[model samples]
Target: MDKAGSEKSIIALEGWLQTPAGVYMRAWEQSCLDNLTADIFGYNAVQIGMPEIDALAASRMPYKLLADRKPRAAREQQRAVNLTLDYTELPFASQSIDLVVLPHVLEFSTDPHQVLREVERVLIPEGQVIICGFNPASLWGARHVLRRVGGTSFLPRTEELISMPRMKDWLKLLNMGATQSRFGCYAPACRTEKWLHRYAFMDNAGSRWWPYLGGVYVVQAIKRVKGMRLIGPAWSRKTAAAPSAVPATNKRREQQDG
Candidate 1:
């Protein structure tokens, strides 16, 4: 999508996030991100979108930035160095950022593949990227399908839902390995907070029995650079030669003659 279209969709999403269902989804996403980003050590970390949740708050990175198209609304919701820019055309230098977080950005983008390409460009080799999105294999996803099929839209906008497998493929194409993945928020699609709370038991059950069926998923990927190897110093290799075994037997005889 163009910049104006993307911004409008995000604004609508922010409003929807104020509802009970959206509130529940945000809480689940926050918990997932807290666990995922806790150990992501780096010099610079950037959250590409979703200012409603501070994706880098738990990170210890000295430099953290939040980039989005809507800075005014983001400033109201979060406290960080915010940058207004298009996801497909990031202003940062290549391979400079150590980490990037995209929370529900792919599904809402005009060209999700291009967004991923931009993320790949700015992220340093071996850097980490954490992504959170709606799972197409979950109850919430089923509801979305039903709604769309019935000529209605329940989500913030009419966007494509990229499944986990498809996302893995995209990452693989960029030489980024999927290090870890998590799924949570196992509640049915209920509009009211009370109904959502009533089905809270599904959280525990879904975790143990059907974890992958959760409404949301978080995937952490690390960039892999080819032909990268660590080697010891040349001096160490030169000094590593061993003595000949034949010299030991003549040493005692030579000493006695001396």
Candidate 2:
């Protein structure tokens, strides 16, 4: 989609995120992110998109920043290091960031693969990346389809939800190893708060039986670098090199004399 169109869609989704059902999804996502990031240690961590969620609130990293397509006045005033840049073209150097959190960014992008490629580029070897997205093969997804068929629009325009297997394939293409994943918010879509609360039982039941069919999912992956070798410090390498070279040189000289 075009820039203006994408912005409008994002705004609509953000608004929905404040509604009763959306609020329910946000709470589960927050709890998942909090637990996932708490133990993640890093020098530089970044959260891409979804500025309203504060995805890194539980992280203990000293440097945490948010990157989004647009800058907000409140974040600017707070000096929160919110960079206004496209997800496909991050300004950071390769292998610099230790952790990256992408909250509902992939499915919304025009090119989700490009977004993930950029994510892999900025992450250090073995760095962690957390991605949260709406699951397409679920009751919530069914609701989205039914609403569309009934000529009622409840979700964001052009909402392209991705399935778990497809997401795993994308991560694999980027040389990222999928470490863990979680699914939650099993309740069905309900317009009224009362009905939404009533369906809370689905959360426990679905988790025990149909866990993969949750409305939303969180995935954690680690960047993997091939053909990498572990080496000692420069000083140690130089020190060890000198003795080996000296012995070889002396042996060659002695053979020549003989």
Give the Å error, residue 72, model 2: 1.7
| Per-residue lDDT of candidate 2, residues 1-258 (tens digit) | 776777787888777887888878888998999999999998999998887677899999999998888776664313343688898898999999999999888867887899999999999999999999888888877776777677566556655788888898999999999999999989886767899899999999999999999989999999999999998779987887787788899999999999
Q: Candidate 2 versus the native: TM-score?
A: 0.86
Which residue pairs collide, candidate 1?
1-110
Give, for candidate 2, the lowest lDDT window spanning 10 residues: 72-81
Best candidate, TM-score-wise?
1
- Runs in model 2 deviating more than 4 A are 75-81, 232-258
State in Å the error of residue 196, model 1.
0.6
- List per-prediction Cα lDDT, in the order shown: 0.85, 0.86
User: Model 1, 1-258: lDDT tens per residue?
Assistant: 665777788888878888898889888888888888889888999998878888887898999888876565425656554798887899999999999999999888888999999999899989989988888899888878887667455566646687888899999999999999988889888889999999999999999999889988899999999998899898886566535545876897899999
TM-score of each model, paired residue for residue:
0.88, 0.86
